[model samples]
Target: MKLKLYADRMSQPVRAVIIFCKKNGIDFEEIRVDIAKRQNLTPEYAEINPMKQLPAIVDGRFKLFESHAILVYLASSFPGVADHWYPADVFKRSKIHSVLDWHHSNLRRGPTTIVRNTVLAPVLGRPLNPEAAAEGEKFLSASLSKIESVWLKGNGRFLLGGNQPSIADLSLVCDIMQLELLGETERNRLLGPYKEVQQWIENTRNATNPHFDEVHKILMKAKEKLQNPRMKGATNEGGGSDMKRTLHSRI
Candidate 1:
């Protein structure tokens, strides 16, 4: 049987996994798990991923959840994957591991909270939380600073001074892609000051391009809908069906 990746592109980790597979020519069926409809919470999904999360995988009978672990598994298990992604060198690999682990608490925290409050909440039929957004900005700025000064300070374009992008680069960059849902001013306000982070993001995007933009098309569409006043009105009416229509089968 072919590999199966249970994913929803709206999810950052899912997008990352999809991009990695596409980039590496890994043949896997992308099983879309629409989170907006709570498809991930279904009993069948729970059996696949006991944690009930998007971006899980079923490689034959082997089932796995958590995006980071999934990425590592794919990089090592799949042939033709480039060494730059995970690297066979023990110390370099350990550094990549450090970044991925830090990503969970630091890098992941900011974008998830901020995007949900500013744009995603309304789409999910939930109310916006400005207070949370405000708090998230602090974490966001600090995390960006860490990435700029520590991660990107190296000689290479990606993390740890490597010319090629690593799994850490893919994961963190995909995490920040959610910020595309925000308006330009808010996005620039958060990312503009950090020149290194901006350039690094661009490098990662360029390196992964076509596929990078392809996977993020859902976010870009959602961003446009969030901007168009008519779309906004439609999204608010009729039990928010327009909003669902915009996101479903795409994000």
Candidate 2:
């Protein structure tokens, strides 16, 4: 069965699947959803993903949501392609899974919230409260510190017990890419103090992931567009406007 990915091209979760597929040489067709237009709330997308989230997939009769779930499904489905990506060893596999869980609760939400509140909202001509931005930065800083501590305790080439890329790396890399794409200054600020984290990010960027360069280019372009007043209205496609709306709606 041909795999169908429902996602926004510029979304980090979507990019994660793209990078995962590229690295494993798995071919999948992409169905782009413009989140800025609130396309995710439409009944059509709602049927595929009740959560109305991007990076969901349909594989024949099976459908899945959440990037980490998609990664595990893809890895297990295409056996012998990259064993190290999702090792068979029980302990190692558990470790990778643990990090993936931590990612969703801790690292992932913090910086993403910060980026949306501080950068994307202003670009969309929405009000950006400094107090909320400060809160986001605080959360992001705490998450980064946790990541630094974990890296310091481990072997450091990849997350868990591998010298090569693993599911842990893929999960972390996608979120870090989102943080970096917020802007150069914010990127440097978040990554500068964590040398190991910085190195790990660099390694993933240089790895054999086919969509790595493409993802980076898209993010960079998004950042540039967010910074330009003239391109403000035009930059709301993909996850930009939705993210902004979510951020403000929360406040």
Q: Pick the candidate with the highest TM-score.
A: 1
Best by lDDT: 1
Going through the candidates in the order shown, the clash numbers are 1, 0
lDDT values, one for every candidate = 0.87, 0.74
Where is model 1 more than 4 Å wrong at Cα?
231-240, 248-251
Mark the 10 consecutive residues where model 2 has the least summed lDDT.
Answer: 242-251
Per-residue lDDT of model 1, residues 1-251, tens digit only:
89999998989999999999999999999998888678888999999998988889999999998989999999999999999999999999999999999988888889889988877676666799999998888889899999988988778999989999999999999998888888788888888898888888899999998999999987886787776646566554433466666565344
Instruction: Kindly list the per-residue Cα lDDT of model 2 for residues 1-251, writing each as its tens digit.
Output: 77999977667778878888877888888887778678888999999999998889999998899899999999999745578888788987888888888887777777667777777666567787677767767777777787767743577576653578887787777777777546677678777888877877777777754468875576776667555546545655535554455433322
What TM-score against the true fold does each predicted structure earn?
0.93, 0.86
lDDT of 1: 0.87
Question: Where is model 1 poorest over a 10-residue stretch in terms of lDDT?
Answer: 231-240
